[model samples]
Target: MLSENKLWYQNSRMEETKALLLQARQEGFRSIRLNLFPAAVAEGGVDAIDAWYQSLRVLVTYGNSVGLHMIIDLHESNRCGVDASECRRLTTDFWSRTAGMFSDTRFDVSYELLNEPKGEMVSQWGALYPQLIKLVRSKDRHHSIIVGGKGYSTIWDLPPADPDQERIIYTFHYYNPMSFTHQGADWLKAHPSLAERRNIGWGSYADRTRLAIDFRSVDGWRSRNDAPLFLGEFGVFKRAPAEDRVVWLSSVARMSEERGITWCLFDYEGGFGVEGLLPAIQKGARRQP
Candidate 1:
């Protein structure tokens, strides 16, 4: 299951999106992450929104035919802007509408309530977290939902689970020691280097260990929190040296397996190219005798 942030509704055409999805499927990927933006759906008004839904129907319908699982990620609110109150309202409304949109589709799909919700502290997630899950489940009872902690979905921010054991999965993004993974990334505030280091693979090993530790702690908080875990995003910049990138990604795959976690590299093109990394990942995924 490969997950790429393919924001279909944003600055792209429907035919282009279909091509990308089909290409990904051809490249041995079974899943694609999609972000549905309401503002982008209809720049005009409610009438435009209906038209956008028609477009969505066509996209998802075609995606299903191609053996692609669409994980619909509700990303960025127009009104709420990452605040708790705003996130709650935006999440509720988004799920309510999205749930209705795909209710009839037979495609293998999942709902990611929100993408990297900010402003809320890790500890605060314990309080408002369950309510968010409850709200999503209220409308979409059968579909699985992905939930993550605050601080941009870092492993450090996941909340505990309750006794009822709802059908939810834990998720997080990994770009630890941000300087190395995000080098040359213009969007970030910092871009440090990981050059001049020996045993570079251990660096990613340690980062994955940190994620495992965080997951263990979350599990300890509530014994019933045994839901499967997935790494929704993790990638190194394209400019990084190929050797360093391979070592880092291999370590991530090994550590994730040791801890029983499923991880999908961030993308096919752009920063995370499977063409360059797949052979390395395949070697790493193999078990040593």
Candidate 2:
């Protein structure tokens, strides 16, 4: 599960976080990906980041106590693509200072370098990650590093994983047939046609076949490259037909597990909140032996 709550450093946050973690554990979730903002962390300077670090330590420690693994995700990328030199500096700077937090080996946490590389950085990420890997390895050799290709890391856009890289997991986001998944997203409202589109039905034979074909492609990539795959994000917007959302979510989740891909839902408590679809998610999680 992915928690995008921005109140991690705010008052009463721990109580809320504690409740969330407990609920997740009871619900059969094995991990929680904490979506963090790099710009916010950087803007806060040392004091701000120090406080955030303390909160993170609390979450990681408490989460692991309950058998839940944690994934620290840097959830922003807009500022990085402004310029080549600026991108390198900012990307390296963030990891340089933050990677040490994951060095303690005792914590069950992994580092996701960035959310979704776009624009020039998409092409540049392939080159940039090696440096980031080297930087993180310098500080922490115990945790896994998550990386994904550009174009929002969609399955079709995913690049071949490198067999030479150790301790790295290749990731991809899925919201295929966007018309069905993002029907009423506020951000997409600027495109009136898409924004107004609703009630898009799923579960047709073509729909299931398309998903199978796409995941099969990824399975092939994983085999040929000897890489681990993670379905970093996938969900239907809340505004969609509730029944359709359940079906879509269940289908994706089931297919992912069937093919041995580790998956994470898009969010918790946000637009794609999993609260309403827990049944579907749990049902899909039943891995076939």
Candidate 3:
């Protein structure tokens, strides 16, 4: 992020994104998800945003060249939805101005409406989602849009999407058994209870049972939502024990595959690599119906 120039995306950082995407492809992944932090309206007008998009176009072009589809996520807009007026004012405008910007771009770039709608945003999502859907559908029909449930896109209680819309995929982030997955995560530990959740063991019966219950919720949501679902983000932090992290990852991977829901790991080099796409995972996923 080059804040000095006010462009959220910089060419240098894009190099890293590109390198990660290439590494993902080499490891048998075909698509990458990129997060975006939209500069505030106070920052600039259409000209400024157009400049930002121009920089982004270069990166998407490279992604297309390498046979990858990129998902552009609105990383931090969930909070805006708390104030109905602000949510309507900012989100609709954001999508309206930029959704068409990439229509003619040479790559497949999908728009993700919001990152993780927490607190008021979750309960109020139904009030906001349909409007954004209408706004984006009008601008660009060629690209797909990804949306997620509340509770930070948790798998429980997925809100059903309108039936009229097409190419709208549901997404969720997995950090189940937060005690185990988020162990040693500084941000998560700010609350005293989470601070004490570190060093939880994996591969226990309780751990497996928790996995089963969480995935069952996901399965129920899949059956109810009637739209394509995506496992948007799921990873165990690097601070956790390596064997436990792998166990958690393999469990989630198996559940997603068994149900035929596609997914993306949280990151490549950051943490939770699953032994760099172990062949056992690939072969197991292939054998699933």
Best by lDDT: 2
Clash pairs, candidate 2, are none
Shift of residue 156 alpha carbon in model 2, Å: 2.2
The sequence of per-residue lDDT tens digits that candidate 1 reaches over residues 123-190 is 45555557767776666677778887765777666655454756687887777656567666665433
* TM-scores of the models, in the order given: 0.79, 0.91, 0.85
Q: Rate the local accuracy (lDDT) of all candidates.
A: 0.65, 0.79, 0.71
lDDT of 2 by residue, 1-289 (tens): 6564567666577878877888877777889888876566657788876777778778778889898999988776766665656678876776777678668878888888877887668778888878888998888888899988775888866777767778899888999888899987768744666678878898898988898888887877766777788999998888888878888888888887777788998787678888646766666546312
Order of quality (TM-score): 2, 3, 1
Candidate 3 residue runs with Cα over 4 Å from true position: 1-8, 40-48, 78-84, 269-289
> Candidate 3, residues 1-289: lDDT per residue as tens digits?
1112233355656677667667666767677777665655236777666667776777667777788887877765545645656666767767887687777646588888877866567667777888888889888888898888766777874678667888999888888777777776666534556555667877788777888888998777766667888899888877777767766777788888878888877765654444365555556445433
Q: How many pairs in model 2 have backbone atoms within 3 A of each other, for residues 3 or more apart or on separate chains, i.e. clashes?
A: 0
Ranking by lDDT: 2, 3, 1
Clash count list over all predictions: 0, 0, 0
Top-scoring candidate (TM-score): 2
Of candidate 3, the 10-residue stretch with the lowest lDDT total is 1-10
